[model samples]
Target: MTEHRHTNSSTGGTSPQLSQHKHEPSHRYSTGKECNASGSVTTPPRPSGIHQILCIPTGKIYIGSAVDLRARWGTHRWSLRRGTHHNFHLQHAWDKHGETNFEFSVLELVGTSDLLRTEQAWIDRTGCAARESGFNISNVAGSPGGIHAQEWKGFINPGGNEATIINLQKFCREHGLDFPSMHRLAMGKSKLKSYKGWTHRNSVRQREYIKTYDGFITPGGRPAGSITNLAAFCREHELDKTHMVAVAHGRICSHRGWTYATGKRKLAPRTYTGFINPGGQRMLITNLQAFCREHGLDIVHIHEIKSGQRKSHKGWTWREG
Candidate 1:
């Protein structure tokens, strides 16, 4: 039997492959006549802007944002297929339960900065199915407040407490964002407890853990034992606990995690700045040739030299290698 997955974005279908470039076309797909089939159209490039979510079968979900939903789902498709996202827990769940037990759905589309705000509000409010869909229900009610922006007194905030998947798609459409696809596993999470597993605290712990590993030393002098330990660390360090929660659990951590972990280059890959010749001297011909060879470029060629050009070709090189 063919396995199928669905996304809660604009395209309500199962994904086939993970494609990078956030805007590149995926090469593989299924030919079944499924509306959001495993394979149909070429992977649409993810657009720039907005928040998103992914619903899973186990009743557990992932809340996130993207400049491009298409690209994000594509990459996830690859990871899930490759068994990369399958950690010990997930693997065990799959073995005991099944892949069809979990499903992913998008909940909302907010400004990148607003993700934390909405997430915080959701965590604070802790009502409705907002976490499952990522939709800020205030937008549906015509609230004037921005996603995470502070609402002016008496102004109706667009992000309300009634977030849902359908509303999330509407929000994306209103904002011209590419909708994502839902991904479901055959099984459910081992445990399911609202406000217990995968809470804001867990999110914060994930971020703080990464930051700590990346050399961010909290004032506590070392990594704390757990979330409460983090609270203790923050207290000892005199950090603002509220803001710290936002920083630790917000979308910035997830986005930065992607930036730091994936992709070939750190930020901008290729760069070209004029060489810094040491000792205020011209480079030797052999040295230049060696440099070019190391860089896998063609050999040196005499293009042309202007008259009175004081170019040196000898004893003008220094190497620290």
Candidate 2:
């Protein structure tokens, strides 16, 4: 007895057509052309998921989740090649290493609903931002999935009603203040009292928390002098006061060859040294390095002459210190 079997009309044979399984949940393929037995073309699955740009030489990867991987990769490549990419470090690396040295890879398949969470998880698992090796500038992801919103309280205006609070970033944007500076103020890390009339609720406590730095050292590791007010010192030295404060607070280590330290040193009064010119005019200098810096002369060369290692420099003879 012969048995009759049903044939798929699309295939024109007693065989199942591949397109018949297109809607199947288990069917998955990348975006490309799929030829059917009927001479018709079926579109492959569009990849929408996590992607990465890996620097083959450095092994540093920039992970990103996109709805359309091809389109995103094109945009990224365009921006990187044009040197207009938002990620400064990534752009710099791309510029340093040519495009051929980098490899674009699809890391994983993800759905729209799971995009942010999956991306954040991948970033965390890779420790991309946690370490300085990667180009990621921010430790937190773009999506709110991993944010501890409950732990972060908005800054309240102390001058206004108790309930009157504002977003720190918004306030900074509106007033031309820096968000990180204001955030540090709110977190009790900055000694700033206020920013354009917006004061952090913790400003008072922060003011008390920060230890006062009253002394400064020159770039050459010599004691400059005691300075009660950094702003005044900066004004006198024509230096950036805010940068000096940051250095003093240890927020930054050094700036423009100057460093900040606490406690005053009781050193002997700086005796003025004289430089004898060819015409016999004596130039009195309280700080030799400072004078050399002001006159744009090399201090080491001057020191060598001062120590009797050399005869003279720039037609000037170093006298007694």
Candidate 3:
């Protein structure tokens, strides 16, 4: 077997360093190995098989199968520790019990070609999919998992009601809309467009938290006019809604001789740390005002990211200092 180890210094000595092992080549199978959190070696059988993560206190097991059991276990541990695992139930249990209370084990070694079939048989025999039993979400082994895939569409629209259904391809074809774009929106992978009422039967309208703006004011603090919706105001004035909101919140004091007045008080500004590329130069600014003054960067764009309206500002990233 050939072995390779990876040391992660950023973990502060808490996380276990990972070691990967590859077995000598076999005509019918291959094996991978790793070390678990307990500093114990994991059994990686030739090719595929059933695996389990057992919670000692609860006696709850998460049954799974993988082509490479050791690699899968490592992936699970990494995701669970990072709080980004897809299985919320397993993640919750991990959080409650910590690594010490959990055990990773291989149940049976199966041929690579029989992986899915054997896995399905094991799942059926164990009743892993039953609620209050195991952590397996679906009884069907080797099925495509996650919320964004087409397999989940049936789960999302279980009723299959034709009345409420919106055929994405047909609708997009008729309307001359981009099929891929509309498909993504229908699949809940992208934001819904306001221009069309195009929505799938399972589509859930996201509740938007709209902020009320009173009106725009002049430089002398005189009332310009009342505008209820920021988007409407932007359209009427040909101003960017993002920029206007930044101005309204006092991120930028004024835009084009117009000041904003809001009935709701703005949030307290936060300090941010900025880093420049190429040389990794760092700067600390107390607020958007200080950042604008120091860097002479676009005030509106900086405000967008600082206020969480935009993710990135001119290819630069900022975090709370």
The most accurate candidate by TM-score is 3
Residue-level lDDT tens digits of model 1 in 217-279: 234444333343334444455555445554454423322222212213323332223232435
- Candidate 1 global CA lDDT score: 0.33
lDDT of each: 0.33, 0.57, 0.56
Task: In model 2, state the lDDT of residue 145.
Answer: 20
Ranking by TM-score: 3, 2, 1
Q: Worst 10-residue stretch by lDDT in candidate 2?
A: 1-10
Candidate number with the higher lDDT (2 or 3): 2
Write down the TM-score of every candidate: 0.25, 0.33, 0.43
Output the better candidate (1/3) by lDDT: 3
Q: List the candidate 1 regions with Cα displacement exceeding 4 Å.
A: 1-57, 86-98, 122-321
TM-score of 2: 0.33
Q: On residues 1-321, what C-alpha lDDT tens digit does candidate 2 reach at each position?
A: 000111122211121122121122222222233333455654322456665666667767676777776577667777777776656567778889877666555556666676667667767766666435566655565632222222444354423222232444444445555555656766777666754334556666422332335557788998777554454456567789888877776777777778766532335545455677667787766767777788777888888877889888888787774
Question: Highest lDDT among the candidates is held by which one?
Answer: 2
lDDT minimum window of 10 residues, candidate 1: 181-190
Backbone clash count for every predicted candidate, in the order shown: 47, 0, 0
Task: Arrange candidates, best lDDT first.
Answer: 2, 3, 1
Model 2 misplaced stretches (Cα beyond 4 Å): 1-45, 143-321
